[model samples]
Every structure is written in C-alpha cells, then in structure tokens.
Target: MSRRPDPTRRSEQSRQAIVSAAVDLCVEIGYAATTIEAIAARAGVGKQTIYRWWPSKAAVLLEHMTRVRETQIGFPDTGDLRVDLLAQTSAVQGLFASDTGAVWRGLLIAALSDDVAADGVRTLLQAAVVEAKGRLATAQKTGELRADVDLDMVVEIIYGPLYHAWLLTGRPLPEAYMEEVLSSVFDGLRP
Candidate 1:
C-alpha cells in the first residue's frame, strides 16, 4: 500500500480552512450570520470538525486574529522610532482597510456579549500594547521621546484616530491618514 498521509498535517490543514471560512463568512455576512454550519460547509468539513477545534464562531475568528498577529503584525525596530511606528501603524491601517478588518470588526462586536471572546480580545490587545510600550521605552531612552511623556497615553494618541474613523464614523481614508496622525503626534497641533 502507498504511504499514508500525515494525519498531523491533514488536521492542521483542516483547522486553517475552518478559520479562513469563518473569517470570510464574517466579512460577507457579518458575525451574527456566521454560524458553525456555514463555516463547516464553506470549509468542506463536518460541523463536528469545526466544533472539535473551536467552542464557537467567535473563538474561530479569534484564531484568525491570532494568526494575523503572529505571522504578519509585529512592531519593527530600526532604532528610529518614527520610521518604525510609521511602518507598524501603516500595516495596521492596511488591515483595517481589508477583508481582515471586517473579521476584526465582527469579533469586536461579538466580544461585547461573549465573555470568552472579550477575554481573548483583551489578551490580544494587551500583548500589542506591551510590545508597543517596549519599543517606546527604547525610543525614550534614545531621546526620541520626552522622558516625561506617558507611554500609555502616547500609544492611545498614536492609534486612537484610526479606530475612531474606522469604527465610529466608518469612514474610508487614504494612505496619508496615518502619516498625518504621526505628524500631529510628533509636531503637535498648535501652529
């Protein structure tokens, strides 16, 4: 008989497919409409398979966010705080402008009522904050930022506008949006 396929690899493939289907469904139909059955059908696996991997649709979407963070989103360090922040923030802006953004939006909405999802989202956000703070501390040491500047407030100041425009007003802006925000942060608003 021919050699058997690796069950571990096959299981991993199925898991990825389920996560991708969940994200796509959320983008197409919103979180309220994305269900285990739809995800199972789209993934070409049994509903049992999806349930075997995730307790709920929100958990599945959280996996997508986790993968995005691990594989794509990471703060870069070039010893230049401005350049690194621009690079990282640009990547986040890109995510908020794509299908991935829809999935993230759905998860945020779901987190409002799901304690598990809320905890998961909080964990993901905290990890990013810690990472950002670490980079900012280095910049502070290098005199890129004032020693008295509050790192926590600085992180909010950098990212707050993007979230407001994207989530609150639901507006679509151009590439220069984050650049302007960074400029305002770096140069201040008063003329």
Candidate 2:
C-alpha cells in the first residue's frame, strides 16, 4: 500500500499554491479582475479551499505580497553600506520595472479608490517598510549610515521619486535614474 501523506504538509502546499496562483493571476489580470474563483481554478483547488483560508480577494493579494517580500527580496550585508543599500534599492527598482510591477502599481491605484483594497495595500506597505528598516539597520550598525538619519525618511527619499516617475508622471525608470537616486541619497547620508 502507498504511504499516507502528511496532512500538515499537504495543507501547507495547498496554501502556497493558492497564494502563488493568486499572485500570478493578479499580475496577469489586474487585481480588480482577479477573482477568488479564478485563483482557485488556477491553483487547481476548489473555491471553498480559498474561502476557507482567506476572507476575500484583497486578503489573498495581501498574503501574496507578503510572500513576495519574504522570498524575492533578500537583503545582503556586504560590509560596504553603499553597496548594500544600492543592491537593496536596485532589487526593489527591478521589481517595479517588471510586468508584475505594472500590475502592482495598478492595484495600488485601484486600492486608493476602494476601501477594502486600500486597507490591504496599507498593510502590505507597512510590512514592506518594516522589512526595509531591518535592512537599513544593518547599515546603521556598520556606521555607514548616520546615526541621526531617520530610516523611514531615508526610505521615502529612495523610493518616492521612482513611484512618482512611474505612477504619477508616466516616466521611464532607467537604471541611470536609480543610480542617480542612489548617488544623491548616499551623498546626503554619508558621515
């Protein structure tokens, strides 16, 4: 007889599949168009499977964002704060330059108009900020970042222009743009 499968592992795998499917669906079809039914279908699970785990499509999207941050955005400590900061920021910039980035931006804009989506977006951004601060803390300890520099403020300085250019101004985000932002940021933060 075949061995019995582990229920806990099976459940975890299903959950992951659901989240991954949700992310892919949200990226391909805008978040507004990605339904729980579609995510369940893509994951090869039933709609009840998803409904049992998440309250709504927004919840699934929020969970997917958390997973992306955990898996895709690994921050490195290269001893050189500038290199580390650049790498970290560049990783984020690359994400924004990707197809999923366009979807994420659209979702964010839609969130602004939908209260449920807005709450999910706010929670996702808060989690991202926390992760970013943890990475910045490494630089602070290395004495590369000024002790007085506010991590939150620095994060805004690094990301604000990119968002403005991509979302508000419809400008292209060339690598040179990121390099310039890094140069200006490091110049102001260097002790």
Candidate 3:
C-alpha cells in the first residue's frame, strides 16, 4: 500500500492557503466584510478546517501578517549598520507598496473598531517592534549607531512618518519619501 503523505506538511500547506485567502479577501473586501466563511471558500477549505486551527478570523489574519513578516520583510544583517537599517526600512516601505499592505491597513482599521481585532493588532505590533529593536541593537553593537540613541525612539522615528503617510493619510509611499525620511531621521538637518 502507498504510504500516506506527511500530516505535518499537509497541515502547513492548508494553513498557508488559509492565510493567503484571508489576506486577499481582507484586501479586496475590507476586514469588516471579510468573513470566516468567505475566507474558507476562497481558500477551498471547509469552515470547520479553519475553525479547527484558528480561534477567529482575526487570528488567521494575525498569523498571515506574521507569515508576511517572515517571508517578505526579513531583516538583513549586512554588518554595515546604516545599510542594514536602510534595507530594513525600505523593506517595510515596500510592504506598504504591495497588496499585502492594503490588507494590513484594512485589518488595522477593523481592529480599531473591534476589541478582538484590536487585541490581535496589539500582539502583532508588539512582536514587530521587538524584531525592530533587535535589529537596531545590532547597529549599536557594531558602533554604527550613536551609543546615546534610544532604540525605541529610533523605531518611532523610522516608523512614524511611514505610518502617517501610508496608514493615516492613504498616500502613495514613494521610495523617495522613504529615503528622505530615513535621511532626516539619521542625518538630521541643521545649519
């Protein structure tokens, strides 16, 4: 008899499909409109399959964001702190430029309106901030960043404008804007 396929690999594939469906549906129809039934239909999986793995649609979207961070926005440790930071920041900016960014913003807005989504957003942001801090710590260790720089402050400086332009105002996230923001934050303009 033929051996059965690996259950772990099969489960992983199903999970990935669900996440992809959630991201796509959330982007196309806003988070508030994207229901578990729709995601399951889009993913070609049963509702029970999704509910069996995730507690809610928000949880699936949260896991989807985590997957996006892992696969799309991996931090690069180039040994040159400035280049590393620029690359990392640019990755974030690029994410905002992609379809996934639309879904992320939609979920964020929906999260603000709903407590469950808000909790998921909180967990997602906290984890992302921790990752950002870890990368900044590498810069500090390499002596590329000023010893006095507060890592949290640096994170805010880097993320603040991007969030404002992309999330708050819904403006186009141009690469030039990212470069200018990074230069302003890193180099500062003073006569």
Candidate 4:
C-alpha cells in the first residue's frame, strides 16, 4: 500500500504554475488584458485556486517579484560605495531589460488604476529604496558622501537618468551604461 501524496507539495506546484503563467501572460499580452481567467487557463488551474492564494493577478505577480527580490536582488557591500552603487544600478538596468522587467513595467501600469496593485508596487519599490539608502547611509557615515546631503536625493540623482532613458526616452543602452552614469555622477558632469 502507498501513502497519500503531500497536498502541500501539490499546492506549491500549483502556486508556481500560476505565477509562471501570470508572468508569461503579462509579458506576452499587456497587464490589462491578462485576466484571472486567462492565468487560470494558462496555469491549468481553476480561478478559485489562484483566488485562494491571491486576490488578483497583480497579487500573483507581486509574489513572484518579491521572490526575485529576496533571492536575487540584494544590494552588495564591497567596502567601496562607488563600486557597490555601480553594481546595484547595473543590476537594475539588467532587470529592466529582462522578462522580469516586462512584468515590472506591467505592474507599474496596473498600479495606476488598481488600489491593491498600487500598494503592492509601492511596497516593492520602497523596499529597494530602503536597501539602497542603507548603503548610502553607510557611505555618508564613513565620510564617502557629504554629511550635509539627503540620501533620498542622492538615490534619485543616481537612478533618475536610467529610468528616464528606459521608461521614457526609449533610447538604447550600452553595456557600460551604468559605468558612464556613475562616472558622470562621481566625476562631475562638466569636463
């Protein structure tokens, strides 16, 4: 006689399928068109299965993004602020160009009209910002950055152009894009 299969393991598999289907749908179609029914169909599960775990598609996507952050997107500390900043920004640039980036862009648009999504997006973005500020605060404490400056503005100054170029201008980014931005920020804009 055989024992019963673990229901929790099967549930975890369903959850992963739902998440993967949502990510693919968001990337293939836009977020507005990717509905819970579609995700259920693509995932080979019922809408109730998804709703059991997440209230909406946005929540499903948010879980995937959170996993990526916790497992993959840690800000590094190599004892050099500049090196760490470059590494952090470059990783972001890479994310913004990948499949995960597509889902993230979709989430941003979804957040505009969705109260639930807006809160989740804010949480995800703020977590990243807080991680960045921790590093920046360390730099300030060690005297690498000025004591009289706001780390918030410092983060904006460092990332503003990258977001502008990627999300607005649609310009092509070279592999050394973050390196150039770091050089300009640290070495001054004027030659």
Q: Pick the candidate with the highest TM-score.
A: 4
Q: Each prediction's Cα lDDT score?
A: 0.89, 0.79, 0.81, 0.89
Where in model 3 is the C-alpha error above 4 Å?
1-13, 113-116, 188-191
23-140: candidate 2 lDDT, tens digit per residue: 7887787777888889999999999999898887777767766666778876677787667767877888788887658557766877877776788788778877887788778777
Question: Could you tally the backbone clashes for each prediction?
Answer: 0, 0, 0, 0
Cα lDDT tens digits, model 3, 25-129, are 888888789899999999898999999998888888888787787788766777765677778778888888888887788778878677767887888788778
What ranges in model 2 sit over 4 Å off? 2-13, 113-120, 134-143
Whole-model alpha-carbon lDDT for candidate 2:
0.79
For candidate 3, the 10 contiguous residues with the lowest summed lDDT are 182-191
- Residue-wise lDDT of candidate 4 within 81-106, one digit each (tens)? 88998888998899988899888888
- How high a TM-score does candidate 4 get? 0.95
lDDT tens digits, residue span 49-118, model 1: 8888788998899988998999889999999888899999999999999899998888888789998789
Q: What is the lDDT of residue 99 in candidate 1?
A: 92
Stronger candidate by TM-score (3 vs 4): 4
